[model samples]
Target: MVGQLRTHGELRTDTVTRAFATVPREAFAPGAPLEQVYNRDDVVITKRDENGLAVSSVSAPRIQAIMLEQADIRPGMRVLEIGSGGYNAALIAELVGPEGEVTTVDIDPFVVDRATQYLAEAGYPQVRVLLVDAEGGVPEHAPFDRIIVTAGAWDIPPAWTEQLAEDGVLVVPLRLRGLTRSIALVRERGHLVSCGYELCGFVPIQGAGANAERLVLLQSEDIALRVDGDQIVDADGLRNALTLPRVARQSGVEVGGFEPFDDLDLFLATALDAFGLLVAKPAAIEAGLVERSTRMGAKTALEGGSFAYRASQATSEDRTSFEFVVYGHGPDADRIANEYVELIREWDRLHRHGPGARIEVFPTATPHAEIPDGRLIEKRHTRVLISWPHLTSS
Candidate 1:
């Protein structure tokens, strides 16, 4: 894997390249499927139920490369890995070398045991594997030079920020409402700064750091009104539009022969920016109908009559703009589409470009605490409300 990474110019120097080539990936996988053991693509299927929902897996090679580069691992650097996957720990160990230390922790005991064995078999027993909740992070090893979370975290836990060594780098799949991004945060002068790295996907982190899944099942009699920032329509207007027919359902548009889920999320984010609202539902879950997943992005149900809505938007893999196929017996779909178009026009009027805006995240436990007074931003799915006064122009 490291050899291939070097071929792509991922390894900057011969010393790093040699270390990667010497580390055999097969040693870590141990009797895994042949296709997965050697396949350079993202093929590690860590968790699969009888129904085949992939709960966890090692991320792809390119993603690992991107993260490693962002991590900036150096010799004699102490590294702590959240969600103990042996492959990632081994890579970190290899990068940090013998003088440095690598400790990996996982929430699942079985995963930790397996990873420990795998590391021993691969001659990397030096990498410590622990069975503990990683969201809280392994504070016992305080002041780590670098910390990486293999699983996604809904927020930058104060524990993580507090434990982070000054001038340390923390990399994790950060969940923002409906989507998750591989965030690279560096602690400088007690401030965690984001590099706005590429938007990527990862399974949501479970346990303490996991967020509430916002897709609510509606009751039979209720209704939801959907709106985005690109349009000015409010919840009431959406209720009126629910009387119309669906406008575009499952219309497939491919970009470079690949479904553009990012593009769709961007579109949705745009709507959230102008309208400041998203799908809304009645209090009851049984009233709504299950909406099917799109070929590219979100799958929503029109259960009951309403879904949540957001007033402002930020583009993310989870919050991109895409047309949804609503399943309620109302005009909600038409209403949302019309409002979306209006929001787009307003964006043009205000000279808000369809692309490029940095999303800054600050996580807090209380709803009232840390509320930005200048400009409001909303994460539609989680009903998370925030504001970035500084990001208004972009």
Candidate 2:
């Protein structure tokens, strides 16, 4: 697993590599096959909710390694893990060594009990396993050098920033405009600014910090729009718009096979005024109602009764390359389609290979004059800002 992580460039530092090598993952996930336990790309689900959704799991080793590298944990640094899975806590314990403190907290008592037993069995009895709401943070262990969140968060609570040390780093999978990225943020003056981020997904957080996305179903449970914030939409009109013809426009941007375009998704989420994720089931796609371009829903721009989403067409004989395309439907299909295509071209020209977007988080009460120019996503505790920098060749 360590070798695979190194080859993939996820395990960059020697400290994280050694932590992965030394920790016995099997001890945390007992009764699972050794092959499954060691698989770097698989997540072992440990607990589920009444709705059959995964509430807790031993996260994929690849994600674990990526977050740990982003964290840059040292041998004697105190770390707070917001989600409980015995495996990751043990790995953190190894990284922190004997002198440093490691506290793992979770709202689910079942998860906490399981993690405590597994950690003790795995010889990491010194690690503190607590059952508490992560929104409040572990105040008893305040002022941690590093706080790594394993669940998907919609906002940065005040307690987290208050509990972090002066020069601390908080690595969290934060959701913005319906897209989630594991952002590494550090405090500067009074606000937190992002240093780097990676695309990731995790179970939605529960408890006081839990914020659910609004799902507007267009066709029963198959086709829907996952919207964030108070962005109003004409649900009935959009549902009727789906029955109208779709207008397709080619953006003339070609991408090779297996190329990642998450940056483009993030760019569109910010550039557009109203955006949401268009989710559809296989039945809808098979019936020629939608395209199967992305497994995790399609990036969509909503304008009143009209909506446009991203799609692609194969440009090569062997289907090794694809061209970006936009599909729009509604009263103003042509205009929305062209608008979506223009943004696609702009991304290819300006930000396809640039430094990407810079994200920063400030207090909600911060004056508008003090904030930077960008898209502002208002959360309960913080105001998230995303700004794109222009790249110039030296």
Candidate 3:
């Protein structure tokens, strides 16, 4: 597993690679299958709620390695980890070594108990395991040099910033627009700027920081729209529109099989006026209610009741290349789809080969004039700004 992580460029530093090599991932989950513990990219679900939804999990090894690399932890630096599972805490313990302190916190007692027992059993007894809501960070152990949040967070709580050391790094899997990106941010004056971000997903954080994404069901339990923040969704009107005739448009954009287009998703999420993720079950796709691409949340644009979602068309018999396509629904289908397609083309023309978006988080008290020109989104704790800067050709 460590070898695979190194090959994939996730285990960048020698210290991180050694941590991966040293930690016993199987010891944390006693009864889980060996294949599961050794899986390179799959997460092990540790706890679930009454509704059968995963509430806590040991994140995938790939994500753990990526976040650890982003963190750049060194010996003798105190680190705080939010949303605990025994394995990740053990990994941090390995990186921090005997000289440093590692504290992992969670809101649920059951999860905390499991993590505590497992960490002890895994030979990481020195790591502190606390059952506390991380909304108010562990103030008792302040001035952490590195803070890594494993759960998907809606916003950057003020306590996190308050407790972060002057030169600390806070790596969180933050939810922006409707997409989740594990952002590595550092303090900059009155704001925080991202050094880098990686595509990732995690079980949502619980307790005071819990802000679950709203799902608007359009086709019973099969199809729904996943929205975050204050994006107003008309469930009744959208449901009616979903049954209307489909309008499809093809953008003159082609992509190779292994090419990464997740950046385009971020561009649309920030550039579009109103955006949400259109998700559907496999049955819905097989029944022709939506395309196969939508099975894993598709980027969607909304105009009142009308909506449009992104899709793709295979351009090669070997299915090694594909063209971007858009599908629309409702009275404003044509306009929504045309607008969506234009943005697709614009991304392909400009940012497909350029640096990705610059994301920053600032306190709500920060004046709008001080913030950079971009899509400014207001949250309870902080305001997020996303800007795409143009590059100067040499």
Weakest lDDT window of 10 consecutive positions for candidate 3 = 385-394
The root-mean-square deviation over C-alpha atoms between each candidate and the true structure, in angstroms, is 8.3, 1.1, 1.2
Model 3 spans > 4 angstroms off: none
Cα lDDT tens digits for candidate 3, 1-394:
8888888888889998898898889887778898888888978898888999999888899999999999999889899999998898898988888999999999989889999998888788999999999999999999899999999999999999999999999999999987899999998877799999999999998889889888888989899999987788888889989889999999989999578899999999999888899999989999999998888899999989999999999999999999999999998999999999999998887788887888999999998888978888888899999888764466
RMSD of 1: 8.3
Q: What order do you get sorting by TM-score, best first? A: 2, 3, 1
Provide the clashing-pair count of each candidate structure: 66, 0, 0
Model 3 C-alpha lDDT versus the unseen true structure: 0.91
**Per-residue alpha-carbon lDDT of candidate 1 for residues 235-274, written as tens digits (9 for 90 to 100):** 4443543444435432222123233334334334534533
Best by lDDT: 2
What TM-score would each prediction reach against the true structure?
0.67, 0.98, 0.97
After the best TM-score superposition of candidate 1, give how far the Cα of residue 62 lies from its true spot, in angstroms.
2.1
**Winner by TM-score:** 2
Model 3 pairs in collision: none
